[model samples]
Target: MIELRDVHKAFGPKEVLRGIDLSIGKGRSMVIIGGSGTGKSVCLKCVLGLIEPDRGIITVDGQDVTRLRQGSSERDAFLARFGMLFQGGALFDSLPVWQNVAFRLLRGSLKRPWTEAREIAIEKLRRVGLSPDVADLYPAELSGGMQKRVSLARAIAAEPEIIFFDEPTTGLDPIMSGVINDLIREIVVEMGATAMTITHDMTSVRAIADEVAMLHRGKIRWTGPVTEMDASGDPYLTQFITGSPNGPIETLR
Candidate 1:
């Protein structure tokens, strides 16, 4: 469903992605594990066409992502197939929860009457374990976990064919993190949508990924089925997954 071939990206003197070659199959879940500045998010942005790769190719659903001109109908159509849950909940504080969830549905190509959009928003909220009553509240009125769930609801509201989660379980209690993880897994399977997630949470990785790829020094260090991750015997991956301070990965402290 998605492929990156020898992808390279750099900002001025900083090289982020260096020949990243990876692919996620249709309806499969692939999680990227890496430390800060390792280019996990940059690779994702390249595929989304938010950042252009200086070298190599990125393709999604057989279309060359690099070739799609920004702001064109083709680019809009290309992006319409994806739903994203940003690192932060990113909800509009002024809008009620339901309106935030239905934000996409009320505008642009997916636009619908306010009444219909609200109904769909409510249904999606339910799918994410949120009650209809909570829909009338604003983001500031909700707890951290509830807000994240609302973000999840919004991501799936459009019924996208692909979903990208950027740190889906950040800034929550352990139980809430687990709840979000389980919900993400369930939704991906239920929707049969291809999933790409970048997170530092090992638990989320184990819960959400069918396959795991570890990026080190702007390149793929190790990648395999999640089942084989523990036994991959790669120092870079071990250092990452185990959170060990000592390994091929250099530490500041």
Candidate 2:
């Protein structure tokens, strides 16, 4: 449902994405794994049209996203088909939980009656394992796990066809991360949404990915089904999943 062909991005002399080519099938979960600063995020941003690539093409459902003008109604409508869960949970500190979850519904083309939006928000919160009472509180009142669940609720509130999770398990303990990973896997399957996630968390990758792509040095070093990942025998992927200091991949220390 999504494709990037020969995509490239650079900042001054530092090239981030160098001729990236990738595809994600409809209703499939694709996880991109790599160390920091390897351009996984940049590749994602390019697909979302947040970053204009220096070269090549990106398409969603066969529509070229690169041509969409930012702030134009067309772009807004195009973006409406997608939802995002940022790494930080990124909730508005001042808005009540319901408001934060119903943010997209309260503005732009998705606007709804406040009462209806709040009701939908509550339903989504419940879906993510949060009680309705939690909806009236501020972000500061929630723990990291709760905040992450809230962000998850917000991502699916609009029932988007595609979802992007940026380091979905970041900053959580092992158990909490497991909870979040399970929730992400469950929700994506239930919604039948196309998912693309980028993370260094092997646990998250193991729990959430149907297919995995290893991004290294700004390119896809290896990609295949999760079942075959451990035996793929790609040196870079082996080094990454094993977290070994010795291999084809270099580590500074």
Counting clashing residue pairs in each candidate, in order, gives 0, 0
Write model 2 residue lDDT over 1-253, tens digit each, in one string.
9999999999999999988989999999999999999999899999889889999999999999999999999899999999999888999999999999999999999999999999999999999999999999999999988999999999999999999999999899999999999999999999999999999999999999999999888889998999999999898999899999999888899
Top candidate, metric TM-score = 2
Model 1 lDDT per residue over 1-253, tens place: 8999999999999999989999999999999999998999898889999889999989887899899998999999898899989888989999999999999899999999999999999999999998899989989999989999999999999999999999999899999999999999999999999999999999999999999999989999898999999999998888888898999899998
Which 10-residue window of candidate 1 scores lowest in summed lDDT? 235-244
Whole-model alpha-carbon lDDT for candidate 2: 0.95
The list of candidate 1 runs beyond 4 A from truth reads none
TM-score of each: 0.97, 0.98
Candidate 2 error regions (>4 Å): none
Q: Which candidate is the best by lDDT?
A: 2
